[model samples]
Target: MPPITNVERVYQERYAEAHAYLKATNSENPFMVIRAENKFIELLEEPHIPFWMRAQCNAILAGLTDETADARKYLKGAHTSLGYFVQIRELATGSLSDTAGHRLAQLREQLTKIERDIAAREAAKEQRSAQNLEDDKEMLLEGQRSAQDLEDAKQMLLGPEQEMLHEPVVTDDTRALPKTEPKPASAEQSLEQGTERMDIDSDRSTATLFPPHTEVTADSSQHAADSDTDMTSQFSDNESTATVKMEEDDDEVL
Candidate 1:
């Protein structure tokens, strides 16, 4: 065979790269799968003038179509990828056509398995959500019942006197009355109060003259006698002071 031209070599390399992406879709990584699908589209967009190039393009298209069909089935849209698989299959030929047919068979098997797994997971999730909702509802009702029971117990435990404390005191005159200032004491009342106060002071002084709960011993009698002598001396000094003032007046008059 003659050495391949640069253009043919390039197409071969790109064809292999596209196939690698197609195989990557099996990994089930969403981002990697999306990138692989885009790569396939890019290769299909290239000019496939040569028969070999066109065959490679057809193979990539067939793979892409099957992958998209599987995804669409999960999304619940058109069960088919708009008849794209039929169109790509018609374009495939020889070894390329055989490869596409084998890949499609494998993809269909994988797609069926994936659908079952997805359905099972979704059913389990919905069941768990429903159970959690029921649990929360029961808890809320239990809390409300507990509160009601506590209130009933409170009513049973409280007597009439305790209940009366909680009740508002209602009266015929509910309106507030005008505030009245107090009157000042009259002169007669003031004089009587003063006299009463003086009498109280005199009684307090007399009580203080003798200590309470003491025996009348000779020492106590002597202490009383000493107090009387001190008072008499004070009176004599006052009288002497008045006599001095009177003598001075007489001298001024003379």
Candidate 2:
């Protein structure tokens, strides 16, 4: 005899229990049948069960159930299982039954819609990312421009200040020269003194050059006396004028 596999052993045990439950005809023991159905459903969930078989089991469960909600739930699970099994089988065998082919076409339509939605979302995301990058680039350029403007402004502001700092400064020590005290005799005073000296010398020379004849000597002496008096008066007038001018200067200064 062939060695009994784990799957076969499990199936045998489950079949025995289910057959026993079905064979019991006690009208008061409906719970036993329900328990058997639940057990069968548990077997369907096992990975060892073929997906197609599980789908068939779920469909039978849906038909046997009286509750509309439970029936729909079972049917939906059956449809999902059937779709998975058909996709896997078609990949391996490259062929499908009519029912599986129709189900696959419906799944393909759903897949196409999902793929389109995903592509649209990705495209929108990429567009947003590109827009954000462009915005960042613009912001960076703006910042650079602003920084450059600030630097230019700083240079403009500093230019005149630097020129002023470099320019030569004229302080009292640099500009002032040592002064000499002025002599008291101005050109006018010196000129008057020189004229007076010349006149006196000429008169003395004239007096020495010729002693006048005795009769004219008395008249010459009288004329010389009158000239001497005029000279004294002129000297006095010049002194008064100089004094007045000095007073005027002093008043202006005050």
Candidate 3:
């Protein structure tokens, strides 16, 4: 076989690099995967690279990027490349290598799996969002009902008290009347009656203590006057005798 040309050598180097980058997708480091995707994108820009290799590289890049739309595009390109490869192989005398066929099959399977996973994730996200909305609605309704019930309870508890406060009060107007003229007159009459009864009682008591009185005649008045003079002369004689005895007692003491 003739020595490989410079173009063939460059294509081999780029193709190996792209495959190496694709393998890094399984690495734990996200930076490694990102770097690998960038290298694969560079491979796509090379003119010497075959269309089938470009398709596989794009599928690997899309998988590393983890984007649904990019994965779908890569899947489409991969299918087209696969169909062309099959047609070319049937017409050619020698078929493509088993390794190349295996790589194409692997690329197709990976793209299909990516599409299915994206669909499942989107469906799950939608279901979670719907469930959260239902829960929020139920919570809001329950809060409104609780607030309404509390308001109703407050009204029920305070209704009678409010009515009692607002009710009209009944009172006896007569009890609040001012003093009248007839009341003073009645009070003065009672005082006068009490004074008259007291005076009459005193007079009756004095009469009971004194002797009874008889009619006065002219001769009886003269005899009573002479008796009064004799009584007065006897009182004077007794007083003179008391004075004479008091003097005799004083002389004896001296």
Candidate 4:
């Protein structure tokens, strides 16, 4: 049996109340021993018992602290203290069952593990956030560099184009390239040159290939006819002279 708490004194003081509560209930038919035993056990289960025990222990401890006593009072105080210790132990270990303690221990372990897991996850998330920030910084730098390069390229291109547009087309150096020249020949010029060449060729064509042209001479033809007439007259005169000589010779022969 557990040692008596200070409630033992209270129950001793109110023994009549316990007896009256027993008489009022069905517990009256039973022997007072059994009835009192059951009622006392029920009283142990009451909310007031723990507070009452604590107050009694504090009172005893206070009295012991105030008094410097010889051997008998000291022994009595020790006995009361021992009894109070036993009652507290019974309230703590006896009322709080083994199963309840086990359950509480499991809950404590689970709560601790959950807290540790949450902490680790938060740390990892913070690390990832830092890495993401670094990556974003690099990306921003790369974007700025690309934008700068593109701007420089655009400026260089526009400068050259402006210079080319304002520059002169012709140069004093013969080695310098000429600008876009005329691609087509004019039709009137081609036709005039062609007609001039055709006229010159016609004027000199067959005459130049053979001899020079000459005038026909009518006087030469008349002179040749007169010479033929003179030849005919001389032949007639010779024939007449020959006839006359033949006659003279005939007379001499006679």
Candidate 5:
């Protein structure tokens, strides 16, 4: 209150220094340039310190302590800086913590999207599998029906096939199939029946299979004509091909 003395000026300077220190220690926020200059003037005018400045001084002392190796190291790098702005610029420029945090967040989001897509794909695959299984079942049913039809046909022909196998020669019993229903004869079989009904041989051998036809054993000259096929249309129409069936019957009309 009285005339400001050197002791007061010294005390004010100490107080401002303490606050500045606190700012560095994280106890006080960063001082504006004008505010710091004001503190410089105030320290010369009065010998008292504010609560905020006092906190700053405490923080400053903590940073200055020899055991605070991390603070010392940071301060060492800051020694190259001209002002607080350099520190701000260095922090804002590129920080590993910030980049890593951003990348981690992005990766987490991507992972979530990928997981959702995978789940959807799996669901679609399962649906497709189910559909395919259903289709396969239908196909199996159709195949079963076809197989059953084939089995029925085979069963129907079983008796006829056995009779034919027992005797390759067509007998009276084999010509007439069993009651289960004889398989319809092919065109070849019908032709064979016509040939059996009409005794027309390709070779002039006296081999008469028909009862009505007379048995005749021919000599060499007749053999050539017997083999020739210039015959009736009705006989050729019924049986296109002539088989060389010969007979050794005792009865000879020709």
Candidate 6:
């Protein structure tokens, strides 16, 4: 085998140091575990690390953060780093290949879980937004109905006064009494009244010409008989005068 170059030697030393830190993470001391995790983070922060080394560092950090709030970020980093190494066909030992495969499987499961959780949260948020909008619309409609009810109540309370105010005013100028004209009598009624007056006048004239009759005594009865006898004697004298005139006319003719 060829001797290792200076660059190769430096890489081996750094790699050995990172491996020592990974071993310290198993210590019972909490401070040592934190220190080891910090060492891994420091190596990963270096800009010139090899893809295989970065993949191992990221995989360790992903396992550390697996149950923590940083699981998604670290898991995604480990997946990406391992993908880059595999895409470039990097030479991995049996143990390293096994670790990469295991870490990739774990990362994939965690990433899928995180994505599913995110989609569920987004769906819930949209549902809540739609519910809130519907609540607001109901509130607006209720307010409008309340306003209309108030207006209707006000109109009902003031209805009588409004009608009175609109009523026509009554004054002396518009209160003239109606004139009563006498109805003209019909011709039949006039004729009836005239006939009644004529009957009354005729009764008055007859009463004036003929006085009321008194009780007849014997002397009044004898006077009526003397008037009858005088009327008979005057009628006999008229016949005797008419005969004498006829006798004179005969003597003149002789």
Best by TM-score: 3
Candidate with top lDDT is 3
Whole-model alpha-carbon lDDT for candidate 2: 0.70
Give the clashing pairs for model 2: none
Assess every candidate by TM-score: 0.31, 0.32, 0.34, 0.25, 0.21, 0.33
Candidate 3: regions farther than 4 A off: 1-23, 26-103, 170-254
What residue pairs clash in candidate 3, if any at all? Answer: none
How far in Å is the alpha carbon of 194 misplaced in model 3?
Answer: 41
Which lDDT tens digits does candidate 1 get at residues 1-254? 89988887887787777667656655343323434555555565677546766766677556566665565454343225523565555666323466766776666555555456556655866998999999999999999999999998887888676979997786856446766889999999999999999999998997798657767899989999999999999999999999999999999999
Model 6 TM-score, 2 decimals = 0.33
The residue-by-residue lDDT of candidate 5 on 75-149, one tens digit each, is 334433423444465588754367755665564554455345445655866998999999999999999999999
- In candidate 6, stretches whose alpha carbon ends up further than 4 angstroms from where it belongs are 1-98, 171-254
Each model's lDDT comes to 0.68, 0.70, 0.72, 0.60, 0.55, 0.70
Q: What lDDT score goes with residue 59 in model 3?
A: 73
Write model 2 residue lDDT over 145-210, tens digit each, in one string: 999999999999999999999987867674566678887998999999999999999998987876
> Over 4 Å off in model 1, which ranges?
1-79, 82-100, 162-254
- lDDT per residue for candidate 3 within 1-254, as digits (tens), equals 88978887787787787566556544232233434554565677687776777888877756665542443465566667877877788579476678877877786676566446556656866998999999999999999999999999999999999999997675866655776775455888899999999999999987777635855589989999999999999999999999999999999999
Q: List clash counts for every candidate, in order.
A: 0, 0, 0, 0, 8, 0
Instruction: Tell me the lDDT of candidate 4.
Output: 0.60
Q: How do the residues 125-185 of candidate 6 rate in per-residue lDDT, one tens digit apiece?
A: 6998999999999999999999999999999999989999997776667456676889999
Q: What is the lDDT of candidate 1?
A: 0.68
Give the lDDT of residue 124 in candidate 5: 64
Candidate 4 C-alpha lDDT tens digits along 29-123: 22222333334444544556556644543453344332312322443454467457656866877765688556655645544553454456558
Could you tell which candidate, 1 or 5, scores higher by lDDT?
1
Root-mean-square deviation of every model: 19.5, 26.7, 19.1, 31.6, 32.8, 26.8
